[model samples]
Target: MATVRGEDIVNTARTALGVDYVWGGNSLTSGVDCSGLVQQVYARYGISLPRTTYNQINIGASVSPNKLRPGDLVFFDTDRKKSGPDHVGIYMGGGKFIHAPRPGASVKISSLAEGYYMDRWLGGRRVSGVSADPSSGGGYAEEVAPRLDAHELAETYGMSYAFFKSQPELWKLLNGAVSAQWTPERFQAAVKNTSWWKNNSDSVRQSQVLAKTDPATHKATMEAARVAARQLAVKMGAILSEKNVDQLAKNMVHLNWQEAQVQNYLGAYVKFSSDHVLGGMAGAAAKAIKAEAYRNGVAVTEQSVLNNAQYLVRGLTTMEQVQASIRQQSAGLYPAFAEQIKAGASIQELASPYIQVVAQELGVPDTDVDVYSPKVKAAMTRANAQGQPEAMNLGDFTQMVRNDPAWRKQPGVADKTLNVGRQVLADMGLGF
Candidate 1:
């Protein structure tokens, strides 16, 4: 599951390959600035992250570059004038990251070994709520300590914590559940199954410790189980109050039912208990399941669920197996593509493969092919030809736009200014 989630992050980044870099832009089709791309990709997984590069650096726990993981946010102080973070990129593991470099440069993978980047590297920040389990060791640790006081815990964890803590009976029941001998993996899976557990890292750690201490403590085991169950109940209650039970049921088509199958049963429970008969206890659990189902999507049957689950699990495994293959293909090709663009390849020639790869990956029609219209091309060409002697590159064409009076004043005289006036008359495109 961890591997699958990581691959999803990488795939999402890959889908944005070749998108033109635009300052302060975020959307894929329109354009994306550096931070915007990272923000949108994480948002797809229900993780709420800050939008700005500066804010992003401060949100999650800090980690050293050596300890950096695939989804970690790596920051840079691009301008020495800035006191802190000025730019950011999503670490794609193996000493590479995807970022929008600058104007005239599209989204691309860059090496950390580059001297320019090494000098500006500021460190990394991990996103919160992404679990710190040893099995999923890459996630950042929780910076804030857990609240011990029930009232404080209630506030810290939100209403779900309040609901469970208010019922001492339920709390004791759950404490017992955690004390039982369950496989560490199974215990962690159960913790994630509940929405409350998903956000409470401290609680998860405590439960895991309790479960590992002694196998003979039935009361401890039962208490832990009850807490988990009550947490689930509170989540369901919240969903029921929102009147989204039906919608939750509809979302159950994506889960692997054979593994846990909790969504189907929870969907039925929500349908049966609309009146809040169980002191609104069942409502919260139902709502929690509905919320998870909505985010993760649900599967219809056991087989379908298993197949989907296997697909994700195996997809991640396959990705690792073929990493060399993908990198080999990409490394040889991407640099050549970059070289071609720099060597005066037409925009069509330069952008066609990039557009096709990105379009196919993102499931969007290829629109990048038409991004540079013929009119724009002609204008650029005329500007280039006119400014050839005085201007050498795209920057020269830009300067010509600013300085050439005839090119600017005559509207369509770009060709005449360069070909007839400058080249023929031995006059520089710049009048001065």
Candidate 2:
């Protein structure tokens, strides 16, 4: 879709980002119909749209799908069982459109580039005073069109249009994410809630923003995440063949993951597999894990994938360490090794910080311990890595790592805390 330089219609449409879909309803908070949603939002800026899908589709000059811009109204022949512009939504560029889907559903955002909408797409119409095509006489749309589409969209969400627009980079991000059909609320929540956005340096925040929003960047990172999660799943799955891959798929459904989110979470679940781990573990564990990680300041950036990879390596090494040390180290070494661990590190630090320090001191190969690829490791230190992995200074998983081995073995602080309760856990030997 084309980018226009003036007031963005997407701006106003956002005010209703997550409203419920109430047939015939027109309130943004209470809900609205597809056309009601369109008309009400546009009306806020005084742009009139006939309060029905048929009339709304006729409000502006026709725009070809390929040439559609942000404020254009896209019509769909939804209910293919039916015909002709039965559905209407605002195109938000990058192949996404925003609208209130049908009953029992909320006024959520969705994509026009794919899914049912792609097949149903009828056409688009540019309202909100976007310039008419140069071929259409190089004039603007009627003065009656919404005067402040972009500004209104930002205002509805409690942000300044000037501040939002001034950051071309952020707009680029919003364009990519919204175009990808990410809800504005999710995008906003990510910004306000994620540590990478809240506490990072300005440059790091921009990089994190780009990594999360840019389709190409997010795609690549997600691909790696999928691979990592899958590898973890498979490796752990192999240990419990009875549990099977189908279990993973079921876990996804039961968790209510979107069609797009299943694979990524499947990857994460695989990364976290254990005999005691259930498919159910994924749903509860993910939020808790992410929340804990966030609280501890783990920056889930492009580097975070590496950090996960590092975690995979660390877990592998810990197993290797246990096996090797079991055979060679004297009984006393177990207690001695446990003594060196410092308590209260965050989970991020656990991957390498807690382990590697001791592993290196204990003569673990740099090969076995420093898992980050040299290039990724280097990029991490740079304030600007062009969206590549940066130093994951976001948060640390250190203390968690330090506490674990202590709980499992030797006379450490966590040992006295009654892990004594796990004998049945030991007895079952159940797994992922």
Candidate number achieving the greatest lDDT relative to the actual structure: 2
Please give the CA lDDT of all the candidate structures: 0.51, 0.52
Total backbone collisions for each predicted model? 43, 28
Tens-place lDDT per residue, model 1, 89-193, is: 877776678887777888888765454676688988877644332345655433232113332222222223434444454354334434553332343344446
| lDDT (Cα, tens digit) per residue for candidate 2, span 160-259 | 4554555565455555554554544455654465443465555444434344335476456445544544554554332223244445433432333353
- lDDT for position 347 in model 2: 26
Where is model 1 poorest over a 10-residue stretch in terms of lDDT?
250-259
Cα lDDT over the full model 2: 0.52
Give the TM-score of each candidate. Answer: 0.31, 0.31
Tell me the deviation in Å of residue 158 in model 1.
50
Candidate 2 shows a clash count of 28
lDDT of 1: 0.51
Report the C-alpha displacement of residue 382, candidate 2, in angstroms.
99
The lowest-lDDT stretch of 10 consecutive residues in candidate 2 is: 330-339
